[model samples]
Target: MATLLELREEPHWSYSALNTYLNMCSLKFAFQYVYKAESERTAASLPFGRAFHIAATHHAQSVMQGKRMTLPELHDVFAQWFKLECAACTNLTFKNGESINSLTEQARFMLDALLARWIDWNNIVSVAHAFKVQVPGLGKPLVGEYDMVIKDGETTSIVDWKTSAARWSEGKAGRDFQATAFSFAYLLEEDHGMIPLFRFDVVTKTKNPSLENHYTQRTKDDLYRFQLLALAVERAVKQEVFLPAETSFCCGDCQFASACKEWHRSSAAKHICMAA
Candidate 1:
């Protein structure tokens, strides 16, 4: 099976992309996937979350191999990635006095909380496992990675790790489209009769970090609805119907803020004016 990076080379959709289109903004998606505009700067939180994710991936892989990392070791893992990510980032934007050092402290605290609540089950099936689902009527496939997959007794679960500044709200997991799409992908690709459980392990960022697990399940009807949504998004993308969600909360932190402001001016209009 091709890795997620390899799968990404071809035209495809993922939970993140769909979230950007549906929840974030469509013009942002067009700026990214269509116009291929480069972001002026990388947000500080973006790299911080990614570094934490990479560190968590390391921890999960170690657990799968039956050798969980110690707290200091895990902190070291996170620090290494955070430093590397920050160095590579161009024009890293920081807000509210956030710096590399501050984020590192937060990562340490979050990891400590995570290790304290670590479950001892070791029936690891896959870590950072990638999957590609082919939906009918769409030319492309939906490709993504399952952070971790494990079996406890007869029940199998797909686990995703997340680091957040605040605790997740009630029923947020149940409403997440990622869980729905991931559950749908697992069913189609694995051909499992039983619905695989979807779980999110979210760690909050604070002086005293906390870890919480939220579980969600998707049924056949949910999967059917998800497929229909995928088809609709695909149709919209094909028609080049991308538009800005001006009132979106995400606009404050949008990467394409500049491009969005200039969206009203088009090359076609410029050419027409010159001809006149």
Candidate 2:
């Protein structure tokens, strides 16, 4: 019975958080556990993605509660969420000269396409389902809010929504840590030896929006890999090994880049003084 505030204060591991640690340990450690110096910045595509998820979750919940919404009503809901999200985010900017109005229109198109393809809402067992499971070999519980879980007799399907400009590949779905973790969590909860089908419903943000469904089934090996990853992350945290990872394209958007650079300069200066 952990409150949202308590969960935020507690140390927990998630797929995105662990990926952040792997991408740049110093940045993840500073942002997650230490004093966060930089303001959290919203990416340009986040508003649309958030709006899409909100709309989708609302629709799913309504259907699950035996009150399905019409397509037009869902579209209006998405529009309202998109408008509010755009107004709240002051730093959102598009590289392609796309304004908020234009993005909203594109999101509408995407929503329409998504609704057209997502006609199987009747199969959903849970929407925005929250779960906390103790992963083996990890100290803290892994918490996640799944988008949708569809149960068909003995078989189960996990649905994740994605709003992106490009369609996702099956290979990417297979390698996705979030999908692997969700499957593991679901298995732990059900204990049903059933391998759930993971589906990624991607809505593209193009002039003419498109919907792509990518499917992946997590094997025991995948779950083992995730467990190993979680164990390694826990060990790193205990050992205080938050070293800066090698520079990559992700460095361009890193919030801790300035602090990391300053620390490097100070270390180099100290070494020079000692050698002199």
Candidate 3:
């Protein structure tokens, strides 16, 4: 078995899934799952979710171009990630509860719940089939891995996981950008009444949906925010303007703390120093 370090170093990207995406990108940029391409186009314009990762890479590149992210800068860079991911960054800035640690914890908790929920997805989604796809045209494959690639009989999709709380929203039922990015990434196209739809199976774990509560799922407008958020992040990454954005909710319950020691300045001290 590959070590966690190895897995992180080389994620299980599905070439079958990614090949299909590059094919589309090279062949006039069409998607089977995108009803709204504008937002996704915008997100694709930059690297939103991985802002901190990019920033770290850039800095690392300044000294050591191909080096990996150090153990210390992970969380802050993760928090720095939200700087370009407009959705929750703005919300956290507005709500004043956006602690990097808090949001990170909530995201972690949500993913735990999502994994739990996914264990039962075959049940929640009555009938579905998963097919390994090979997108045409790209020089290289695109997907890191398909978490739960499936065709719901009713629609074609590549289900992905988002950890931020602001993404728990719905609107046009089956079309949201976070979901659309994957659709575009996978080159899904419109079929039947369903356009290329990206579903947000948000996992907020709690009997009652409260601020501090665990996880929840949705197909809502907040998902639209997800689209916007994704666009913003991608855009910012291209610009290389990943200045750290300090927000109230941006740094709550951050798990990268243990791994990201350089940012901590000392081994024993825990918690991020508020953005100065």
Expressed as tens digits, the lDDT of each residue in 107-220 for candidate 2 is 667878877787665688877777777899899888777798898777788999998867776599887878898899888874556668998988877788788888889998
Clashes of each: 0, 0, 57
Alpha-carbon RMSD to native, per candidate: 3.1, 3.7, 18.1
| Candidate that would win on lDDT | 1
User: What TM-score goes with each of the models?
Assistant: 0.93, 0.85, 0.31
Say which prediction, candidate 1 or candidate 3, comes out ahead on lDDT.
1
Candidate 3 per-residue C-alpha lDDT over 176-233 given as tens digits, one digit per residue, 9 for 90 to 100: 3334434444443223233334444443323322222222233434434534444443
lDDT, candidate 1, 1-276, per-residue tens: 888999999888888888788878888888888788888778888888888888888888888777889989999988999999998987889988889998898788899998999773577788889999886666788899998898989999999988887899999999899999898888878566566999999999877889999999998888888888878877878766677799999888888898888876966335445655
lDDT of 2: 0.75
Clashing pairs in 1: none
What's the residue-level lDDT of 12 in candidate 3? 30
- Name the runs in model 2 displaced over 4 angstroms: 1-9, 23-29, 66-68, 87-90, 190-193, 266-276
RMSD of 3: 18.1
